[model samples]
Target chain A: MPTTITVTVNGTTRTNEVDERLLLVQYLREVQNLTGTHIGCDTSNCGACTVHLNGKAVKSCTVFAVQADGGTVKTVEGLASNGVMHPMQAAFKEKHGLQCGFCTPGMIMTSIELLERNPNPSEAEIRRGIRGNLCRCTGYHNIVEAVKFAAAGTGGKK
Target chain B: MVTMTSAPFEYMRPKTVAEASRLLSKYGGGAKLLAGGHSLVPLMKLRLASPQALIDLSGVGELKGINSSASGLSIGAMTTYHELESSVEVQRAAPLLADAASQVADAQVRNFGTIGGAVSHSDPSADLPAVVLALDAVMKTATQRAGRDIPVERFFKDFLTTALRQNEVLTRIEVPKLPANTGTSYIKQSNKASHYAVVGVAAVITLGADGVCERARVAITGAGPYAVRAKRTERMLVGKKLAPNVIRNAAKRAGAEISGSFNEDVHASAGYREAMTQVFAERAITAAVANAR
Candidate 1:
């Protein structure tokens, strides 16, 4: 049987009729037309589908939509405020943190969380913190720089 | 074939533990309890685990919280790893749990994975099975009629199988307070990709008044079918002073508890796992002793 669920996504509340087995990642892209969350790997690895559920980053692919019915989700699309990019997003753009851009959204999502947990993280901490989200672009040098840039504030090249 | 989504199944979200237990009884083997869904969902996606129904216990209020007393801690089964890793009470009561829980997987997994689901799944390579076994945690379960408590020694049965009955829902795990002068540690060589432990060892050691070994509990996981106590190693450490040589010799016997052949898979070969078990056992015991006060 299909269940009616109300979930607050980004800042908007959405009500959807979903099957029991629909994954949250699929629900976001298919039902809600939010494709920012990408699925990079079948095994819970790669972390390409990272999103915030009730303020904690999680793999959207592994969670059932029903499980997240009453929760709040923040995706990459939710990062911008009134046409202004989130600091983490701005940092990524400033540091040239993309090659193929396949894993950029997940990386941005995870980096924002890393900074939130540790306002000023060490280089090793930044690397360890983003270990879950993998960028196949193998451009981790700039990714780390981007996180540091965001952590160092919006100042130019701190 | 590896797929990305779970197969068709009925989903039931119960608001209470008793209702969850009743749902489990109603569905029997056809029902699989969903907690965190970190381990089971991946299997379901790959078609490795398919069930007719799923009973999600996330909404069960009774199955969530941490109650502490002089005796020990009663952690709700639905508590997430992030909660366990960050709880001040858990850190004060059983710091080894918080340490091991923090190292279970990456940060994202820690946010959503629950200790109960990990323990119930009994994946041979999971870090918690060995940690819980060494800590001597008691699994508390509920059914339609009553609840039962099963000690950790008998809880884990085989690969991906536990003593959890089909009709019973695991409610909480009771971890006894560690006596004074005791310290514990868990160490694992995780697989590079999945981060599952290839060989993990957990040791809880208590030193006597004279600094001689008093009581020791050790468990090994990933190298065998399931986590089991390293009785031979524990027995060796009971009376001897935990010098470097004695700890090394005792660690050599850590693999004696495997009743059958060692687990062999893409993660590690049998011989390599057996050798690494002894290595990690020594590391875990040494680390435990260093922290023993």
Candidate 2:
């Protein structure tokens, strides 16, 4: 069966008839063509498909797209304004937080939510905050540093 | 193979609990209630569950929020882990539950997973079951015909099973506020990857004016088919002061109530969980006793 859902993606409000089975991650990638949200692990474990459902970070694969109906969704592509990098994105680059970059989008999305909950998180808090996300490259040391830099919020350009 | 998407199913989001109950009754076993979808949705994707319809409970206004009462807290079934973890009232009233909610899976799962959902799903390794069990919580459910309140002791039946009927929806969870001079703690030997407790224990200990043990509620999870109270341990601790030696001896019987065989998976062998159960029970009781004023 098809479920008609009206969702505000990033900032754009749109409605579509979607299969009830479609995952939020699949909807973001296939229907909207917003490929920045990577599916590093189709299962919820890797946290590669993390996105903000109405400002709360969730494993997109774990949520059916129909569940996001009438809600706002923010993805990695939604982070920046007018091509300027979001502080998190800039921090990842400056702190060398990626090797293969498959988990970067999820890591960044999850960290942004993490910093929102605890604006000034410690190194331990940052690591625990992003535990859902897996950087298979074992780039955690730099990833932790990048999250710290992002939480610092002073280095990224406007 | 990675099955990323759920199978086809009809979805309905009702505004009231009564309507949802009616829908649940209509579909009977063909439908499943969708709370946070942290458990059911994942099961659907893996093809383990293929319900014909999903009655999404997120939109039921009555099924959300936390309310304080004379007895304890009347928590709406849709209350998420994040909500429970971050709620100031929950922190003060049932800190053990709040802390356990924080330790479930991780941030992303916590953001959406609900207390009612977890309780209804009844995953043996889930942290909340043991906490609720130790807290002597009450689970309320509704159907088109009537509503039933099942005590936590009778709530969990077996592995991935509960006393909940097919046509019923768990409405809320009532967790009691700990009395003054009482303290509680939940500790677990968790799987490194999934964070599910291999052997978990939740202890609630109240001290008398004389500093002797007044009452104790100890529950263990993950070591067996489902969470169960360590009645022998609780009985052993009630009249006596909780010393390390006393607690150690009492905790040895913590897994004795696990009927039939213990749960053995890749994460833990039966014998390993049996040993860890005693260790965690002792640690949890010691921690709770220390926390008591």
Candidate 3:
């Protein structure tokens, strides 16, 4: 049965009727048209579907849309404001953190959570922080550098 | 990308533990109690689990948070790995639990995966089972019939199975505080792909004033069908000095003590798991002893 869910996404309150089994990532992509939350691997291993549920990063594919009812969601689309990139996004671009760019959104989302936890994570902490996220390109070196850049820019207090 | 979705099911969010248990009892085998959904959701997407109804426990406030009593720490069943890892009480009272929870999967999964869900799911390769087993934590559950407390040893029955009845909901886990002069450690050899432990060991030791072993508890996971107590190993160390040679000889008995066939997968062969079990056990016990002093 389809159920009605009221969720706050990207600072906007929206209500929609979604199927009971519709995944949070699918709802974000298809219903809200928030395609920035990529679904790289439906199995939840790829971490490309990472998003903030109630202010914490979680695999969107592993969560049913109904599960997010009355909760808040933040996607990569919500990161920037007023046509300006967030510091993390700017750092990614500045550091060339992405290669093919498929994993960038999830990487940035996961990295945002990582930075929130540890504002100035060492290279080793950065590697362990993103163990759930996978990037087949860029060898993760640039991503590590991008996180470092963001940490330095923000004084590690994100 | 694989567009896998769970099979359609009715979903209900109950507000209280009693309501959740009643719903579970009413639906019987058709209902699945949803916690953090890390384990169930993935299985559902894979079509391995297709419950007709899902009793969403997210709305049940009764099953959340961490509390400490003289008996020990009482962690609500829905408490997430993130909460466990960041909790000062957990770190102080059960550092091995914090160590194990911190190493589960990644930040995203840890943010949502609940300890109750993980323990109930009883994944052979999971980190908590071994740690809790070593800590002698007690599991509390509620059902239409009654509420019960299950020790860690009797709680886990087999691969991916627990002693939980069909209509029961695991309410919380009660872990006792370690005694003075105690030290604990949990270490795992993870399969890089999934981060599931290939061989994980958790050790807790209490030393007498003289520094001889007053008590020792050791548990191993991933190298067996379920986390099992390293009885022979514990027996060896309980009253001994825990010297380097004593630890090495006791660690070797961990692999030999398991009676069943080891889990063999692409990540590791039986022989490799057997070898790693001893290696991890030795490291975990040694680290625990060092921490004890």
Q: Which number leads on DockQ?
A: 3
DockQ, Cα level, model 3: 0.73
lDDT of 1 by residue, A1-158 (tens): 88988899999999989988888888888888899999899467898899999898998888988888888999999999999999999989999988999999889988888888788889999998888988887999999999998999944331
The superposed Cα distance between candidate 2 and the true structure at residue B198, in angstroms, equals: 0.8
- Relative to the real complex, the DockQ score for model 1 comes to 0.63
Q: Grade the docking of candidate 1.
A: medium
* Cα error, candidate 2, residue A158 (Å): 15
Where in model 3 is the C-alpha error above 4 Å?
B1-4
lDDT tens readout by residue for model 2, B1-293: 22345567999989988888788778868999898998888789889999999988888888889998677899998999999999988998999989999899899999999999998888989999999999999999998789998999999998899999877888989988778899899999878878889989999999998889999999998988888899999999998978789999999989889845789888888888888999999999999999996
Candidate 1: how large is its RMSD? 2.3
lDDT, candidate 3, A67-97, per-residue tens:
9999999999999999999999999999999
lDDT of 3 by residue, B242-267 (tens): 89999999999887667557889888
TM-score of each: 0.96, 0.97, 0.98
Better candidate number, 1 or 3, judged by lDDT: 3
lDDT of 2 at A40: 75
